[model samples]
Target: MSGAAVDAASGAPRRGEPRPKAAATNQQLRQQAVDRMIEAAIALIAVKGAAGLTLVDVGRAAGYSHTLPNYYFKSKNELLRQAYGRSVGAFRRRSGAWRRQALRAPVRDDALFSTMLAYVHGGCADPAGARAVNLIAAEAVTSLPGLLPEVRLQNERMLALLQDRIEAGACGTGAAEAPASIEALLVLAALRGLVSQHLLGVPAADVDAAVRMLHGFIEGGPAGGRSAA
Candidate 1:
C-alpha cells in the first residue's frame, strides 16, 4: 500500500500500472464505430441511393470525422457492399425461424410456401431494412454496376432456396412434381415484385391481398386455372 497498490496475493504491481484494458476497450470502441458507420451507410443508401454514397458522407452521418469511414473501410464500394450485406443479414435473421421450419419439412410445398410468406411479411416487419435493400437493388440495376453482381448473386441464392425446396418435395414418392427451376423462378419473381411494391408505399391492405392471391396461385397447379390440355 506504500509504493503502489498491492496485487493482494501477488504483492506489489511491477510497473505500478493499474491494468490495461486498452485492447478490449479499443476493440469495443472499434466495433461501435463500425456499427455506427454501417448503420449510417444503410440509412444513406435508403435515401440517397447506393450510386450517391461516399465514405466521407457516411462518416459524417455517423457523427464522426469525415475521414473516419475511410480509415475503417478501404473504399466507398467496400462500405456499400458491407452495408448491403448487413441489411441482407438482418433480413435473414428476422426470417431464420421460417427458414428452419421449412427445412424441417422440406418435402412439403405448403411449408415452403409458408416460409416464403414469412419472408415477405418479415420485410414489412422491418421497413427500413427492406427499403434499404430495395434502394440498393434498384440502384444496382440502373447505376451502381459494381453492385450488380451482388444483386444478381442474391437473386440466384433466392432462386436456389426455392428450387431446393420444390425439388425436395418433387423427389418424394407419389409427389406431384413440377419443373423446380421454373416454379421457383415464378414464385420468387412474384414475391419480389410484391415486396418491391410494399417498399414503394403500396397500401398494406393491397399488398396483403396480393400476397394471398399469389399464395392461392402457388397452391394451385402450375396452370393455376383454366383447362390444362
Candidate 2:
C-alpha cells in the first residue's frame, strides 16, 4: 500500500502524509533557514568585510541552494538591515547584562569604569559586529527614524549610570560636580573611535593606551575633566 494509505490505517503520519499542521512546521523551517543564513552572512562579513558579502555567497555558506536567500530576503540591503538589527540587539543585551552586574556590585567607581571598559572591549573585539553597528547607527540618523526611541532609551540609561557614579564620588574625580551628558557622550565617542581605529589595523597597545587616557580623563584627570558647556 502507499505511504498515505499506511498512515491512514495506522493513524500515523507516514512518509509525507500531508503533515497535519504542516504550515507551522514549514514556518519554523523557514525561520531556521533564515537564522542560518544570517549567521553565515555574519561569519562571511567577519572574514571578508561587508563589501564582499553577496546573497549568493550567504546562501551557499548557509548550505542552501543559490536561490534560497533571494527567496527570504529581497535584496542585499534587506539582509544587511536584518543582520545589523540582530547584532545590535545582541550588543544591547550584553551591555544590559554588564550594567545589571555593575549595579549589583559594591558601588565602587572602579567597578563601573571596569564594566564600561569591558563592554567596549567586547564590542571592539568583534570587528564585523562593530562595523555593522556603526553602519546601523549612521543609517538610523537618516533612514530609520523609528529606531531613535530605543537608541535614546539606551543612551539615557547609560548616562544615568555614569551620572550616578559621578555623583557618588565613585569616579574619584575630586571635582565636586556631576558630569554632564556631554561628558558621557565624549567618553563613548572616544572609545568607539579607538575601536574603529583598531579594526582598521591599529595596534592593540595603541588602543589600550587610548582607552586608559580617556578613562583617566573621564575620572577628572587633566585631559578629560573640563566641564561641558
Which candidate comes out best when scored by lDDT?
1
Provide the clashing-pair count of each candidate structure: 0, 0
Off by over 4 Å in 1: 1-23, 98-109, 170-178, 203-206, 222-229
TM-score of each: 0.76, 0.61
Maximum-TM-score candidate: 1
Clashing pairs in 2: none
Instruction: Please give the RMSD of candidate 2 to the true structure.
Output: 7.2
- lDDT for each residue of candidate 1 in 86-137, tens digit (9 for 90 to 100): 9988888877765566567744446555657667877876777888888888
Q: Clashes in model 1: which pairs?
A: none
| Displacement of the residue 165 alpha carbon in candidate 1, Å | 1.9
Q: Can you tell me which runs of candidate 2 are displaced by over 4 Å? A: 1-24, 96-112, 134-179, 197-212, 223-229
Model 2 TM-score relative to the real fold: 0.61
The 10-residue segment of model 1 with minimum total lDDT is 220-229
- Model 2 per-residue lDDT at 136: 51
